[model samples]
Target chain A: MNTPNSLLIRRSRRSSNLSFVALGLVAVGLVMMPYVVYQSVTSSMVMLFVLVIIASMWNLLAGFGGLVSIGQQAYIGIGAYTVIVMADLGVHPLIGVFFGALTSAMLALPTSWLAFRLRGDYFAVGTWVIAEVYRLVMIKFQFVGGADGKSLVGLSGLDPVMRSALTYWFALGIAILTVLGCFWLLRSRIGLALTAIRDDEVSARAGGIDATRIKRIVYLVSAAGCGLAGGILVVDALRVQPDAIFSVSWSAYMIFIVIIGGIGYLEGPLIGALVFFAMQQFLAEMGTWYLMLLGVLAICAAAWFPKGLWGAFSQKTGFRLFPVGYHVAQRFDTPVDSRAPLFRN
Target chain B: MQILDALAQGILLGGLYTLFAVGLSIMFGVMRIVNLAHGDFAILAAFLAILLVGETSFPVWLVVAITVPAFAAIGYFLQRTLFQQSLNSGPLSTLLVTFGMSIVIQNALLEAFSANPQRLDVGQLATASFPVGPIAIPYIGVLGLMLAILCIVAIELFLRRTATGRMTRAVSDDPDTARLTGANSRHIYGLATGIAFGAVAIAGLLLAARSSVEPTAGSMRLIFAFEAVVIGGLGSLWGTLVGGLSLGVVQTLVAHFDPSSSILAGHLLFLLVLAFRPQGLIPARSL
Candidate 1:
């Protein structure tokens, strides 16, 4: 059932305006949480939220930009190690996260130049190989625990309460910024070019969309997100290990969260994470069965709910929670402006 | 002498590599899902064989005999129910589906078999060896090599000679056209998975004979098989055999020189091959 373009356009028009009230309420709720509640967030648990942010970026890249990569952990490891290195030089870990993100973005530049040459699964395999190369190189270096990894608490002079609060705030800010950044980007011209490339790269190129360049931007942004997340992850734990940080499972976890939640929408990871967290709590003792059940759920969801939990929700409810872009009606047929589908071209 | 020794040993390991890659290659060649759960299936077979050992005082060979058919039946059902409808939706969807299956199998195996590692008591075959010029080669190694050769040949003949095999070839080659030609792809995938899992059961026997088994072992085996398939270029069955041998030889040679470098050497070989021959040493016509 192909939807009429005009209806899609009308729908898109309605979702453009931001619901600032909703955004404010959410932001206020987060800020209102006390230090104890903030401290209650463990590094691994908090980092899962960061993973959702990174996955959203990847979803944009692969889902909307059509750049599938299995090696985003390369940037993640790079980001994490960069933080450790910077901190070793006496920089505050919080500030080190920004630098780490920048470093990862810089690394993605050369990688994108090479990876951009490949297409489909070749691109994915190239990324994996590149990640391995990065891992090998990291192993040769001695300062950051090499393959064995190192503790990030070398500068443990900072107060514990302060550390947790700052780390929590940093993670939250990054998460918000990442989500907001994606929302803004998805509405712009580059976002249009990316969406075009995703649908049909050849035709998109023929239409003078610089597919390679847009893909490069998406890649760099995704790297920054993963890198920052990785940095935060290391800082929260005050540890850095190449194998632990760079393991393919890191990216696999991102994929799982994204797939289960909803890859194409911002709300997917949030909903999926809540569900995942609950599942983890209940089935923690089952060990391997827990992983297996999640795997089965992921497979079943992917096969049946390709759009994911949020995607399915949107289709059923026809409601937009975190809508980006919009179909603004020039005629002003509806009062108070309404929400519409964002992907309408 | 050491290099020669390594090469001979690599060839022997290649026998297991053959067992690993052949099943994966066959599934990929036919269904194209990469069967991420392929290695887990091997582990499952090993567990089943161990259970059979407990129930009856049957020879390991007898256990292999019983489990192969049983696993094939399971594979057939899994394909028909889960994989067939989802086959054509591009690689990521399929990859995700298979990955999920892998997790499921691993967890299921853990629950059923517990986390403790088990070893197959192959009596003296593993410890016993045949004398060669200045070197001793184990009988199990030779037996593995022969088994690989026999199975490869049998699969080749089956594909080349049989009607069902021809259908498998046709569907694998041009699925849409095959559909137009009245080939039922789901049934073919079921048959293909059945055969792949069936062979995987035998591979499990050899694996249990060679080393201990546990839940986590499948992913490692999967990586080796995956490397072989990629290195071979999904070119053909023979290519996987060559790929497996080359990988085994690389690992053995490195291990002969230094133990830590063994894993590194195999991974390095993959990187080198991928850089130079991304198409693989030999590629199947369609992969």
Candidate 2:
């Protein structure tokens, strides 16, 4: 749309169109990767995708929605448990992934009621405690393997290579969907409301935004995204352990990735996940030192580079893979009057 | 008889839990900073005591006495530098930086001490207890309770009577306004953090005396302390006491019937409190 000022207003930039095509090409390439890439490489890709999904979900909640929950492992565990338990009951693990998202979103409803009570820092701890509650509760349920955990059954009938390939494919598909989901969500009217609420909740509320409701929606979406990651995680690992699935380390990893990559940017998690994957590949043997390195890196990122690596890069290059903001640019076709006044002045 | 015995034990446990929580309370109350590393620092203090005990021929209590003041100094230094920077960045930065610190400390301890659980040797104090009819109260439990009461009283008195305490409260209430009134918020925050660190170190030492602690033990303590703070109410010291005691009682009572469900019971109680009374059981009227 062009205003009287001869400027066009639009959401998508020229780069976004290019990014869309690039994203498509990458998706197609990744879809064919399992067929050509080594099985071990495929497994690693699955983990990378899982990290990307969770990190993005966390970024959505914390960065955009301003809800910094350190307990998202609650949904991850719930997702894994749901998928594995469904496998026990004669459902295919592939189809169970969607169910995982559904179940997580369902669970997040009750969770938000309890968790949303606490402000800022307290909310983070509240979510974590809630996750702990879920973990402890899951341990008591003997039907789904209880404290000892259970292996993913029903997959034994399929060929090992086929199962791995299927898992890899699902991971890739979901990772793509999660990224696209975030991009689409952020470019919508809800996204506008989210930005308003994040910048100033009181002003946003005064401006007629349903701040609580919008935040709840974002929280549910994030929970669903994490749940999808967890389902794929179970399928990839072929087991479900309450402690392992519900581990706070997942949140740590998510927080670390978001902080280092860029907390509020859509492209941040993708970059952070890649860096994390490379670090993991090289430093897997370092054990606790590797974790310490990650911790130190995260602290440095939060302290020195609050905008994160991508945020800095974007600021310098003025590049964006996904642009969620509306921009105004002067129309080139009608720009002929340098002598005319630019404004009513 | 069993219930009464459990009740006594729970109360003693409550004292230790309060000790774990008060430092966290002060940090939040004063600086509005949630130290995610609170539990890890406690474990770090316990480990420091262990190292001291290993190096010297001194008793564990003496080692703890030495370690507490040292930890206070470290806390003051850390807050003045690292925490102050994060606080300037915003709450997200504070959470991320502290969370990162937590992971770093946990991993460092793991690398230094391995995964093996270590405990402080209290000698006869480990077994010494006084009989109250059917209930036997351990000497260490009584000591912990006494020390907890003393610490709380001391802190309360310090906040009420001392000039530094008044400045700390002013900063807690409004850092900018306090600064306008000639108080240095950063210095006050450092002092608050120092006291918190000292208190938590004592909590850690008592925990080591009570049970074996490993590198990974910090997160559990973090949760317990956090739960106590939330249940009792934020920014209220006595509320923390109440929260800790109730949490202790609930866990013990549940464990008496089903051993595995004790921790779960505490979490449930916290959630119930959150659901019904989000302001906490005894909400803070003033910092």
Candidate 3:
């Protein structure tokens, strides 16, 4: 009995509810991973979490905000460096992680002013140049270890197993926070403005969206998130080398993950990270050949499947694990059936 | 004397950079696509030249002559197929495709020719240089500067005078109108890319002659070329020379004072130009 008089608008569907349960299960399993898996396995999982955080942040910036930055490793280096420096100053490395995020966000405010001068593709190269600037500047600062870089000083006393577990937990928590934060941000008014800006900047501005302000906010968030990931990376590696930390390869990984999994979708990074991690593990023996293959696959995905693997899958099934869009359902004036129709055409 | 020497060397370095940038400018001007693989393609040419020199009995000049034309053909085919399709999809697709190509080319080169840096054996030319006052100018550097000027002049003339060049300009200005009026935009685009590729191959040969090149050397070259283009102003051929020269002078001067800061100084100059004068030192009237 369809009520012609009234229509109900909502976001979640039956599939979303099922997805919630599945996600909750996955979360619990991830939290319990260290207990069940070997130490080496948990150590590798730490990298997976870092990838998730960085990829999600990148998606927020490029996919949603239309800022295709190719130099995000600047913040990654800053974050790692901040953590190392903080530890050198006698502050705990764990506490320094937050400082990493804070420092990156603070630096991003100034960087946006310079980077925003160039539009579209030029913006991409501008950011890369800025990142190069950051790397060169870092190399000059001998107090912060200069080109030689510094080690994670404060973590010398912690037990190896305990430290790894703690690192894993921190990574997991941050990855989850990044994803949920992005989900909530998208569901808010700012997210709507970002979607509009992404589709067409001129129209979005014409429609009263403060495109610059929103884009700035997204850029800051992305910088902070990448910074946090960098902090985690240094803790895992136990040393911070300027060249290794600030390498553009980090940007390449983020771009490849976003393009392969799904560009705009929230779930895309998660799925892409799993696939990337698997590939990294299996193709470890292949040296740089596997990277070439990854590059080829990314090109194919961009050319043929522009929507990416997750995007194509969702388009076919009309099922969203993270239903970020609204749908309308018809309701009668009288009491309707308790079971809401799943397919609300 | 040191400063004078640096300036002379810097001018020569700028010539090399101008060569790299001209190809990039052509691609961007015609297609509104920044070829991220521009540097990688240049590197590939250098590597190929090295291989040819090692394996074949041909002279270096003969190898360069063969490779330049060969790369032009390759460029035309790539544009007709890979780049054209990516362009049809949109700007993001083009960026991703080119970026992916950069990584693929880099890794493939690494696989084929180890990580060791290799240089083109220009024999006695590498060591020969003449002194002017307190400054020394290498014969190879002068050759590169002459080549750079020659390529830019040739391209400028081609785009300005040739009928096909007019077709390219028309397509760039209004693709839809050009298509309606009987010009095949695709073919014109291919021609532009072919010219760019040929120019970049020359840059590669020069780079190899000047210094050693490795698989990983392409990214910095891309940055240098990109900086030159932006500082010179997009779509302006002569402006690229101005931009490249300024960048080279700044880097060399900085290196004279503090060795580690040479590249940083060049990058800083570029950023300053970008911040203060985004239009470039001498913006073209219309490319």
Candidate 4:
């Protein structure tokens, strides 16, 4: 004796057509943005692409996998160092970018085995230790500038016009590809499993999900993305310091961007990076207080809103900017017999 | 003889490490929260002592007397205001919140006292040392070890002997049951933070006399304390001491042979221990 009005459970779904249209618009907009900015701003644009790419991967891992890590610098350091290692052997950083990621994947393979042993706090600590190990190990390699951090002197001698354009285009392609990859991944069945795992790992496992394999895949992907991004970072900086490249501060910045932009969603780090860059415009002169401010902001965000800005915005607006999948619905006004038939069919 | 000397000194330093870690252990023992700010609090206390002594010309004991209760009060407030509510949210929230508190405290201290390092001139304690079978034992180092032992004994006794101790143990065991038994678990949480702060005070006294005081000193101390806690196992008090000693010995041995290996040696030791036995050296079985 239930009311027909109460029987309708409307699932929110974007028609596959609207989703593709939205993607095309965003692609066009991103393509057109570079002509509108200054030279330094344009140069910095490439850096931002890499930053967002790496931060997005981290955001996906921590925000979705419930695998809160503090040592992602392991991959970043590895990637950059790998690029340098290749460069020492006379491989161009441009060509060695993929190799750098490969190196990160190799490190992650062993690290994931060991780091997976640690749950929660221990995991964070273990990852940090691993990063330290990477840093220490790097110091033992003299070709990459043990402590001094060698300059990419020869790279500068290459045709300046070709080099800059190629690096920019390379970063752009990677950024776009990573974003698309994340979107596709999130829209898939594995994405559904990831969200399920994030919500509750035990239940997800009980539901026949290969939680470990899923997490490993996510970890490996995250590592590879970080590795590629890191190589680009060194190329941009033109030199890589063991301390700076391997710094925990990079991870901290990644945390800051994700927190501010909104974690869990693909666009969180994108928004976060933009917000962080804007804030840096003002807070850059604040010196050490600036770091403290970012930390405090992240803490406040976590304390007040665990769902992050993205979750909060979604709840308030009832709209998703990046719709991964569709929700099919049956109108409440439809006859029960008709609705039942439609559902059954 | 050199090896023996290293071992003895390591054991002695382990005492200080024990002192450094026990307060953190006590907190974790009663409440399953790890204060990422544990080492920072120790450094802060030491700096406070330095400031206190400079201002009032108080003896080190008097400084500790003042700082212990003062820090206990701060810890009590920190728990009552912030952590008490978040306890049920589990460790992640606790870690983030405490990490925030650490940033607040470190920045506040950094602002109050710049990045310049400070040290205490502990009269004879700093330089005074006696030979034990060809090993030089500094008075300050001996003090650190003795304090560590004292800390262990006192905490163990306090946890076992007193009615408050029983209540604490009960609360730690099962908060709901303790609540049913008419113990206010919230108040107990404050007391736990207070006890932790008291232990930090002792560590601060010993640490200031031992090392140069700087803002980042907390994180560094925290690193050792963390390693000790891990080495000792999750919740055991004595194991912390063993953990500290083992870490100290490992570091000393590395330093003795290869100066560069000192920090690396400690990290590798921790990794090796973790690889084989993640349960730690001494696991907290009861709570």
In candidate 2, how many Å is residue A205 off? Answer: 1.2
Model 4, residue B241: what's the lDDT? 86
Runs of candidate 1 with Cα error greater than 4 angstroms are A1-20, A35-38, A41-45, A65-70, A106-140, A153-155, A201-217, A322-345, B88-91
RMSD of 1: 4.2
Clashing pairs in 3: A3-A331, A3-A332
Q: What's the CA error at residue B185 for candidate 2, in Å?
A: 0.6
Chain A TM-score (model 1): 0.87
Please write out the lDDT profile of model 3 over residues A212-271, one tens digit for every residue.
999999999999999999999998999999999999988888989999999999989998
The two-chain DockQ for each candidate, comma-separated, is: 0.42, 0.87, 0.76, 0.47
lDDT of 4 by residue, B170-219 (tens): 99999999999899988888988998888887787777787778876786
Give candidate 4 regions above 4 Å deviation.
Answer: A1-27, A32-34, A159-162, A324-328, A332-345, B88-91
Candidates ranked, most accurate by lDDT first: 2, 3, 4, 1
Task: State the lDDT of candidate 2 residue by residue for B1-287, as single tens digits.
Answer: 99999999999999889899999999999988888999999999989888888888998767877899999999999999999998888768988999999999999999999999998777888779999998899999888878777888899999999999998888888889999999988899899999999999999988998888999888889889999999999989999999998999899989999999999999999999998987889978667
- CAPRI tier for the interface of model 1: acceptable
**Residue B221's lDDT in candidate 1:** 82
As a whole number from 0 to 100, the lDDT of residue A310 in candidate 1 is 82
lDDT of 1 by residue, A1-345 (tens): 223322334333233235456666867676555443646654445665676677776787677776767789998889889888888898877888899899999999987766665455446655766776678778878887777888885448878877676677778788878877887787778877877887788999999988878888889999988888888888887887787788777666767877888876767777776677777768868787678778878888877777888888788976666655454344333332235543444
Worst 10 residues of 3 chain B by lDDT: B278-287
lDDT of 1 at B227: 73
- Using TM-score as the measure, name the better of candidate 1 and candidate 2: 2
